[model samples]
Target: MSKKILITDDALFMRVTLKNILVANGYEVVGEATNGQEAVDKYDAHQPDLVLMDITMPIMDGITATRTIKGKHPAANVVMCTAMGQKNMVIEAIQAGAKDFIVKPFQPERVLESIKKLIG
Candidate 1:
């Protein structure tokens, strides 16, 4: 079966772009969130196999969201979305239990590769 994934990003464009990438590659886009809090809610609601989360958002940030999800479901797989030069935040997210991360201006290949590596 195709892996189920949740996508979380504040930008509608980014979400749409990622949804297209994941769907075209055969991964199920189980849900989408515009912020970290929503991501957490959707995570619980959908129980997706993996999450693609943005680092910066209006509500809770991705690192906090990652931590929240991981705290509840220790096995939850979260992939943080980072902007260029946010190395420190990326490290924090990793410490919070994120599986991996994709830099913004996302490359479709890398996104799929990260998800595949984490869930497959």
Candidate 2:
């Protein structure tokens, strides 16, 4: 069976782009969340194999969401996606238990590489 994935981003365009990429690569997108809180909720409902999360979202940020999800499900697989490639953010994300990080305006290959490394 195809691996289930949950996508979380505030921007509609980003979510669509990610969905297209993931779908084309044969990953099943089980849920999409517009913010970190929604991502948390969807994660519980879907229990997806992976979560693609964005930072700087309203309601909650990706780092907080990743931390929350990881706190609840220790084995949950989360990858941080954001335009901010700042050192602090990356460090915080990794400390929050994100398995990998992908910067925005990403290459499809890079995204796939990160996902494949974690889930495949």
Tell me the spans in candidate 2 whose CA falls farther than 4 Å from its real position. none
Q: What RMSD does model 2 have?
A: 0.8
What's the lDDT of the predicted structure labeled candidate 1?
A: 0.94
Query: For candidate 1, lDDT tens digit of each residue in 1-120?
Result: 998999999999999999999989899999999999999999999999999999999889999999999999999999999999999999999999998999989999999899889988
Model 2 residue 8 CA deviation in Å: 0.4
Task: Return the clash pairs for model 1, or none.
Answer: none
TM-score of each: 0.97, 0.97
Q: How does candidate 1 fare on TM-score? A: 0.97
The parts of candidate 1 lying over 4 Å away from their true place are: none
> lDDT per prediction?
0.94, 0.94
User: Residue 86 of candidate 2: its Cα lDDT?
Assistant: 69
Write one digit per residue (lDDT tens) for candidate 2, span 1-120: 999999999999999999999999999999999999999999999999999999789999999999999999999999999786566887899999999989898779999999999999
